[model samples]
Target: MPILTCSIPLLLDDLTELCIAYLRDSLHASNC
Candidate 1:
């Protein structure tokens, strides 16, 4: 249970980074 708890946040952080990067790329494409 403890291992799962620690890994969840790491996964979430990676996902958040991916989402932000994707959003930035999409916005840049639209502007050009």
Candidate 2:
């Protein structure tokens, strides 16, 4: 449980970054 708690934030951060990159790519694709 302690390890899961600690890793949750890191998982969220990675997910957030992936979402941002995906959005950026989508925007660029639409623009082009």
Candidate 3:
């Protein structure tokens, strides 16, 4: 349970980064 708790934030951070990158790419593509 402790390991799971620790990994949750790391997983969320990775997901947030992925979402930001995806959004940036989408905006750039639309601009072009």
- Give one digit per residue, the lDDT tens place, for model 2 in 1-32: 33345445566776666666776887899999
C-alpha lDDT values of all predictions: 0.65, 0.65, 0.65
Tens-place lDDT per residue, model 3, 1-32, is 33345445566776666666776887899999
Clashes, model 2? 0
| lDDT for predicted candidate 3 compared with the true structure | 0.65
lDDT for predicted candidate 1 compared with the true structure: 0.65
What TM value does model 1 have?
0.63
lDDT for 4 in candidate 2 is 40
Worst 10 residues of 1 by lDDT: 1-10
Worst 10 residues of 3 by lDDT: 1-10
In candidate 2, the residue pairs with backbone N, CA or C atoms under 3 Å apart (3 or more residues apart, or in different chains) clash, namely none
Candidate 2 yields a Cα-based lDDT of 0.65
RMSD in Å for all candidates: 9.1, 8.9, 9.0
Model 2, residue 29: C-alpha shift (Å): 0.0
lDDT of 1 by residue, 1-32 (tens): 33344445566876666666776887899999
TM-score per candidate, in order?
0.63, 0.63, 0.64
Residue 10 in model 3: shift from native, Å? 10
Q: Cα miss at 21, model 2 (Å)?
A: 0.2
